[model samples]
Target: MQEIVSLNNRISQVIDNIKKVMIGKENVIVLSLTALLAEGHVLIEDVPGVGKTMLVRSLAKSLDCDFTRIQFTPDLLPSDVTGVSIYNPKEMAFEFRQGPIFGNVVLADEINRTSPKTQSALLEGMEEKSITTDGKTTALKRPFFVMATQNPIEYEGTYPLPEAQLDRFLLKINMGYPTMEEELEMLARTSQNHPIDTLDSVMTIDELLRTQEEVKAVYIDETVQQYIVNLIRESRKHPSIYLGVSPRGSIALMKAAKAYAYIKGRDFVLPDDVKYLAPFVMAHRIILHSEATYEGLTQLQVIEALIEDTYIPIRKEL
Candidate 1:
């Protein structure tokens, strides 16, 4: 109980620090942190200039860890992202030079604007949490969270991310436009300077590592586990979905739920936790049929429909 309270307070502090700049998007902030705490990556897809980069920057600034940003373009090369071995004449040997990816928080700005080969560079780093090059493996630092952003409006020259790449993201967040009040506040806040410049680190790398470990220890009842499976199965059988959530999605959902519960100051998983996160975790993983797309049926809609039809388990008194 004491540990839970300590963690909850620390998380709240980080959220508060991020909120200083990210005004009125607590849900997005929480979701991003949830992905981080779950030891997974986040993919932010939205129209450009909706504080997408700001959100990533603020989160990176709030941590006492190395932050790097790679502005992916058509000319970006895999070696540019994962680094390459360079021959050093002075030592008569080749020395490996680390790329921008060797950081705690990496922001892949305009990720889709790059070629598929360049985008695939992140595949190994994101999933394995390490980069293998020249038949050598280099492990990333602890709490290696990726906040990759792509422009949804400009698909003209963008290469669509393959399914394998999409599945690696534990959550796909859309930072919608702010309300009128929020817009005004944002203007006033940034009139002089950006809030991120004044932001300081509220948490350390050690605390973050400990919290991530604790997230995995959050309890999940057996019935809740079954509930997650049921949702996954329902997605497979849904008419609108041509391809359903895979076991990876199931595992991602479970891990996200556990981390979310920990953030909520609870040590046990609840049915509502799974329901709240299912769409974000499972939607991007499913493939909608062409007919369904023509009919304007979205992945979120299909997942919501499935949630409505799936059974919810009740907990009995111990």
Candidate 2:
């Protein structure tokens, strides 16, 4: 749609501005923005001090959305995340106190540090865009997205996210250490204040919602769709993987591939889009067998092999 085109231009401009603060990782920034436009949550799994929170904060600042950061810890309670229902003695009725989950952009810093029960509180919000409390439901703001961060599994004090929770995220990305030049520039900039403070909003909330619609409408040939499905099927069959991508993962890859195509300024998706996104869209959702890990095979590496092992169909350009 023409409306989508306008929103696409706006998104491009916004990411460009965020780049000034983020300084490198253009691909990661675009993917984050893509997940936002798709109205999906993004789980950023990387170690601390690599600008994970900063990336989310900068995007929040750029969107002018209500930003809330929940520092997940071992002691965090479920009600602490989904909000609690309280009785007001004066009103003689139970009323709900909204929690940080109400915001448009939620920075779930160290999400894995929280207990499994606490992490489960986000499921309803992430999937249904609403939260239920005391037999009543409250709708989350439009364009709601959770940008969750977690350290690598090897890190201490981290718990693995439940399979149910992991499937809800549209994509998982890592913001690895910046290049040497970018790091030097970061040091020079941080001498004053955080670079994110200098960022500005790129588009309005309505514009963001419109962009999500656009990604849904991005053209994908039937053959390409089948290609995506085949890849998911192979993941299930692969010897290395104990658990493959679910039906949800199949759809996530399709949407992410469409978003990736649009970022390259294409209205229609190509095979490369599927290949580039296969790892990020499918990797985190998979479970590698203990034997595979013992043999030093990673889930992502297995996914890469699956993509290679599967038969890919070629599509004619629209």
- The best candidate in terms of TM-score: 1
Model 2 C-alpha lDDT per residue in residues 189-285, reported as the tens digit of each score: 8898877877888878777776777788899999999999999988888888899899999888888888777766678888888988888889989
Candidate 1 structure quality by residue, lDDT tens digits, 205-240: 889999998898899998999999999998898889
- lDDT of all predictions: 0.93, 0.86
Candidate 1's C-alpha runs over 4 A off are 315-318
TM-score list, all predictions: 0.98, 0.96
The total number of steric clashes, by the backbone 3 Å criterion, in model 1 comes to 0
Model 2, position 61, has a per-residue lDDT of: 84
RMSD to native, candidate 1: 1.2
Which one is best on lDDT? 1
